[model samples]
Target: MKNKKFFSAEHKKYLRKTRLNRLLISLGRWSVLLFIIGLWELSAQLALIDPYITSSPSRVAKTIIAWAKDGSLWLHSWTTLYETLIAFAISIGLGSLLAILLYLFTPVRKIFEPYLVVLNSLPKIALGPLLIVWVGAGTKAIVLMGILICIIITTMSMLQSFVAIPQEKILLLKTLGANRFQVLFKLILPHAIPDFISVLKINVGMAWVGTIMGEYLVSQAGLGYLINYGGLVFNLDTVMSGIVVLCILASLMYFSVATLEHYIHKKRNL
Candidate 1:
């Protein structure tokens, strides 16, 4: 039989209201986007702004369609996406491992902590010249750039999460004769799941920034290359199209993280 006791009428009413609110909010967001696009297009048609410079939505769409027909759209997008994904994965894996090590060893943390801060503060763009010279103008340089941008932030954030775990819990585990590795894997890591997810979300944008910046410096392929080429050749429409595609890509990545978060929450609730 259904659990009638748990299904209160007020709870059902609240759920319906929440769903309706969410729908309205989503509609409002799209409405605002369409309104702005419409205004922009209308202004361009009326000669209120230079469409050549600003690149209206229609022009961007046309540019994208042309790229699609030429079959370069996916090629460029995939190139950037590949670099970003690889960098993202490496940064997460390496950063998390490093963070755990730092948390486990106070001396190591003390020695490297200041350097991490310095590296994070350093403008990654400034290292492009050095990276190019070191790694050459290749995908390796691009991936390295992305890793440099993301790794320190991931390490710091995750280390903080590890440090923030309840001291009492660790003490309890130790008192119960649980080893360091057991405590880390069974307790610390589990508790830090939300922090790890947050790091992934933050790293998504960082990875994109790193990839595009690297592309700007060295890439012959990718959306960043297209944007740079278009700007140099005075093709504002192509530049805007590249930017729109990047925004779409970033949004998709962010939503994927959000979906993972939702799944995790659902599992926890269950």
Candidate 2:
């Protein structure tokens, strides 16, 4: 009974220490954020910087609140999110299919590799005018931009990982009577899982970049449009609010991808 009580006490102490560490970490992160905002606000108030241009955190917060009350901001945010998700999904699906095709056919892979490298090298924003002419404005253009950004990156990343599988492993599989399909599924695909996760993580940010750039170039709606409108009208607060919202959204998407990466890593370890 005494030993049991001692073990219970030790477990409680460990839990307390873990809770304290978590609280400290959270506080440290928030403290740094608050310090930066406070410094910005102070600079603006002291006339050391142009508040009209730079804006302050409090002003941005108020602007967000006003937009939230009106419902326009949420609508724009949703439009951007929808376009990004659609493009990301299409890119990942098509890229995976294309990667498999490349793996299956040596001639096809050779023909496509140069094209992919050249396309990836080209400035994505430069295609804005052509895309607008081809696909028109609004969601379609944005979705196309996102797809263009992701497809090449995903294809290249996954293709490299697919081909990087050890030759000895492939030989072993073949000797064991595993055919092309079996080798692909059991060997190449499993080896490419981590790379696929990495591509997903990268595309989360790249997709957002493409979506916003498309919107900035030509869009009737979305956070990009809001920021452009704010800039035109000199509504610094509105611009700052849009900036904050974008940061939050991008961070959330990044965190989601990171969580997925962690899950895959853990699963693979097991």
Top candidate by lDDT: 1
lDDT of 1 at 105: 92
Worst lDDT 10-window in candidate 1: 1-10
- Give the TM-scores of the predictions, in the order they appear: 0.94, 0.90
Instruction: Tell me the whole-model lDDT of each prediction, alpha carbons only.
Output: 0.95, 0.89
State each candidate's clash count: 0, 0
Residue-level lDDT tens digits of model 1 in 37-118? 9999999999999998999999989989999999999999999999999999999999999999999999999999999999
Clashes of 1: 0
Native-vs-model 2 lDDT? 0.89
> Model 2, 1-270: lDDT tens per residue?
556655777798997899999999999999999999999999988989998999998788888888899998789899888888899899999998898889889899999889989998998888888999998876898899989989988888888998999999999999999999999999999888888988898899899888988889888888888898899999898889998999999899889888988888898793
